[model samples]
Target: MSSVRRIAREEWRLWLRSKVVVAAALIVAVLIAVTSILTANRIANEQAQRVEQQVAAEQTFFAQPDRHPHRMVHYGHYAFRPPPPLAVFEPGVDAVTGQSIFLEGHRQNTAMFADTKAAADLGGFAALTPASLYQLFLPLLLIVLGHALFLRERESGTLAVILAQGLPGTKLALGKAAALLAVIAMFMLPLIAVAAYSVTLGERMLAAFSLVGGYFVYLCAWGAIVLAASVLLTQRAVSLGVLIFVWLFAALIVPRFAINASSAAVDAPGKIESDLIMLAEQRKLGDGHNAADPAFMQLQAEVLEQYDVETIEELPINWRGVVAAYSEAELTDLLNSYAEERMRLEASQSRIFGLFGLLSPTIAVSSASRAIAGTDLATHHRFLRESEALRFGFVQALNEKHAAELDYAIDMNRNADEAARLRARVNASAWQVLDEFRFAPDGADERLGRAGGSLGILLAWLLAAGGIVLVAARRVRL
Candidate 1:
């Protein structure tokens, strides 16, 4: 045991003395730091720009002159999905998904703008924020540095000499693993610091903690796998090559294949198909503009009767407002239902990829990281749901105001001069009274519960890999 410890210590000293290894480690560390800073800055700037545009658009829409309440319904409103606070760490699927959606009466608009997939092939490689760097690239570095730890010693005839001195294989493997674990810890320090800072900055502490915990287990799994490979391979070159191949398969090939396969499995309909389907469903409900349509006229009569008026024009409530409210409700229902179905498809796609975690710890780590950062597919779906709700609420509030405050006789009759006047006026104060959209952050307990499953998977992988290391130690030959 003492001999094994000495050999491990010597290996660590030798690694430190090697200028090439030291330089490579430094270079990777610098790249991680720079990438994190740059990504954070870029996302912050983009968010600022988006907020400005959203505010400007909202102001312009509200500045419009009063028109038929139905006309205002058609004008609709835009809802912008804001970037999550910790998005800089991962960004995840945000770029792939649309960021802004237009909500109008009687029509459901597919979200528009922001498609990361349109970028060139190499774009993914360079999009190495903290999560990608640690979850994808750092494991490869660990393999490179640690894969030949035992194999090289054996190849060079050092392992037999150390073992002849009564050192057990288990001790030798554990000592080497300890050394490699130190290297992994150093490699992860900067990222862990960033996560801690994020927590201090009011990001969910539990999410950040989960992010760090998942990463630790992921790196440890890499170390264990490398140790096992080292013990199994008789030659240093063979061990290194095998470890590299494993890293490539686990980190790159398998993940890409899973994504493609999951996407195909679900057969997610295109935006156009979604929109057209919603439209068809909506037509079944009475269109507000079809005045002579018996169903719509009947609804109008029912609304008038409910308000205790013989005619729409005689109602204290504005008939145009009432019609707009009903129309908005029907349209909102259609959009919400369609949106939920589409989101379910996306969630299914994610689950398919998640099942591949057994083959690739990279997949597990990436998924866990994004989940904790609130930048995964699940988080994106939540944003869409909330945005849709806010849009409906905003539009409905305006419709209700039209119903309660406007003069029904003038609005319903559309007397030429009166109609013209109504179309040209609305109080600015009324527009100002509309609430601005604000997204609430998820609570700590929610983030923990959400990431718990992914974290458990990663820990299980780590334990299985560790078991492999134990098996390798027992069977290993100098």
Candidate 2:
């Protein structure tokens, strides 16, 4: 223990004396601090703006004057997903998947207002977020700092003298690795502070801890790989080159390959293709606007038999409203079926991507970070589901008002006479009976559960790297 401490202390002193090392460390630390502050503020401002927009949308909806219930359905509503607090660290798919969706009858609109799809008036270098900084550059810095940790001593004969004096190779390796880990801790100070800030956001303690822990393990894994390469490769230049190549392959190449592979493996339909297919299937269901269509004729017969009435006029309810209600229910069922299939396809693609984590710790840590931050595809899917539920329920409620409130005679003649149209309108107070849409993100426990697979992958990487490091350290010689 004492020998290890002495070696680590000496290594630190040397690092402090090197101008390049000091400058590099200072620049990264400052960037971390600046990015953290700016990202946090931007997320907070966007969240506040979305909240205000949501409130205004609800107010405008309920403030409408009396009108036909079907008209209200076409008027639609907007659901703005509130960004989770941890999004300050890992905004994940938030920028690309969009922040809001439009809800109306018979159509499940795609989410909109995505930052990526917005006007590109700004520079294209906006990918430099806090998560990117940690995932991509930090490991490269580690490689540059420690690629020659023990190789330099071995080449200069200091390692031979130390071994002659009875310093076991394992102990020397442990000491040097400790020094490297100490440097990692210094680099992680800004991340730790970010975690602490996240913990104050109420009920995010577990997520915050998971975020910091995942990154720590990821960096530690890199440290082991670095030392293993440095001690085993003999030549410093060879070790440096190999480590840089490994970093590039793991961080950049594997992720892209995995994405392309998953796309090929899954073959999910594009938006336009999906829309066209849905429209074709909908045509088979018969036109809802034509009450004389065979589908509606069968429905009318069923209603007449149920009520034991001879004519539409003798029915106790407005026949038009009943047709509207039936059409909506059938349409909603069709929409839900397609929506579920799309979500299932996306989940499969994500699972395929996750399998590649075994080849790259970068993918593992990134998956875990997004899951912990509630910014993954699963969370976005949850938002879509909640919004759809709101849309379906509100639209159904309006259909109910349409059937029970308006007179059949007035509705049938509404298009011809202004007086009949006025009589067919349901009171605007009907919208008040519907509930507002609010997205519920997963709780800490749920998020941690979702991240479990990726975390396990990271653990496996660390353990495997650690074992290689130990064996390679043992083989280190004069």
Best by lDDT: 2
lDDT of 1 by residue, 206-262 (tens): 677677777889999989988888888787788888888898899889999999999
TM-score of each: 0.90, 0.96
Runs in model 1 with CA error above 4 Å? Answer: 1-8, 48-76, 114-126, 412-419, 422-424
After superposition, the stretches of candidate 2 with alpha carbons farther than 4 Å from their true spots are: 114-121
- Measured by C-alpha RMSD in angstroms, how accurate is candidate 1? 3.2
lDDT score at residue 461, model 1, on the 0-100 scale: 87
Q: Write down the worst ten-residue block by lDDT for model 2.
A: 114-123
Cα lDDT of model 2 by residue, 275-391, tens digit: 778997787777666666777888999999999998888888888778877887898788778888888888889988988999999999899999999999999989988998888
Best by TM-score: 2
Q: After superposition, how far is residue 105 of candidate 1 from its true place, in Å?
A: 3.3
